[model samples]
Target: DRVQIINDGKFIFSDTIAGLNKQRQAFNLLCTLLAPPSVTSLQKISGVTAVETLSPSQFCLHYQPDLNPTAELLNLAVTQNWQLTELMPEQHSLEDVFMNIIQQEQESATVEQII
Candidate 1:
């Protein structure tokens, strides 16, 4: 499946399957979780605006904004094994800019709100 990454220049937010605690998974059910922490720490830099997950493990990160491509970031990509890419938005809406990949199945229940 093609993964969608929603983030600005310095922050990323992704979706996580609600209640699928990674802490309590077997050897297989647990997906390979990725985050900026392991990347940034090893790379050595600062500032995290946000972090989210798509599905249970897939997520993205927005590197430092308004700074020269730091050696650390490059090293992070190489060392941490993070595949980097640039995303261009068709719309500039704030919602579109800053949203995680929430499940439509969960959304359906919210739409069916009963009073």
Candidate 2:
């Protein structure tokens, strides 16, 4: 599994289910029972720009840097008494890490130039 953050503005998550049936089952359950409300609630969250289901087992959320939604979503699930499944925030890809660094540097340079 991998995630890429571009310009600190968009989040892209990718994974495969070729060898993972449990993940698929959980995902199906989430989608069937929790997805609609969760997605709706997430859409109402401030700074959330987009919500998308990338696959049966994967969903991606695009939000502002200030809003880290993992906790909120987990809390929502818990509060709603949904079974807690393994929801992981995968490590950012090396490429994404490098890009984020470069982007920060560029933004810093831009700020300096403006000043």
Candidate 3:
């Protein structure tokens, strides 16, 4: 099905379900390691935009999809003996997309008001 998202009388997004699914700023990965690694070290990897520690041994990495760093991360995990236990991609639902678009629009409006 096709959907269009509007915010403040402006069209924020217009596309099909598949199209919306493909529109993501970054790819999010959840990784669980037996041994914890420094968050700063993970942030240094190319394509990695952000690193969030869910726990001492679990981390969420956000990176550009076009420059996926999964291979590099796996190699580093092996070399550092992090003992990677699990790696999974985060999937967003349609509701998540709608909320994100609305949040973005709100943020943009706030920026415009400030300026």
- Quote the lDDT for 102 in model 3: 90
lDDT of 3 by residue, 10-93 (tens): 899889877887764349889999986789999998899999999989999999878788999999999999999999888787
- Put down candidate 2 lDDT per residue, 1-113, tens digits, no spaces: 53333454643323344323222322111222233355676566555677777564455656665665667667766787644455554345455545555677688779999
**For model 2, where is the 10-residue window of minimal lDDT?**
22-31
Candidates in order: C-alpha RMSD to true structure: 15.7, 12.1, 4.0
The Cα error of candidate 1 at residue 44, in Å, is 7.7
TM-score of 2: 0.43
**Ranking by TM-score, best first?**
3, 2, 1
Judged by TM-score relative to the true structure, which candidate is superior, 2 or 3? 3
How much lDDT does each candidate structure score? 0.36, 0.52, 0.87
After TM-score superposition, the amount by which residue 83's alpha carbon in candidate 3 deviates from its true location, in angstroms, is: 0.9
Q: For each predicted model, how many residue pairs clash, with residues at least 3 apart or on different chains?
A: 4, 0, 0
lDDT of 2: 0.52
In Å, residue 69's CA in model 2 sits off its true spot by 1.6
State model 1's lDDT.
0.36
Q: Kindly report which residue stretches of model 1 are placed more than 4 angstroms away from their true locations once superposed.
A: 1-45, 62-72, 83-91, 94-115
**Which candidate model has the greater lDDT, 2 or 3?**
3
Spell out the clash pairs found in candidate 2: none
| TM, every model | 0.26, 0.43, 0.67
Candidate 3 clash total? Answer: 0
C-alpha positional error of residue 16 in candidate 3 after TM-score superposition, expressed in Å: 4.0
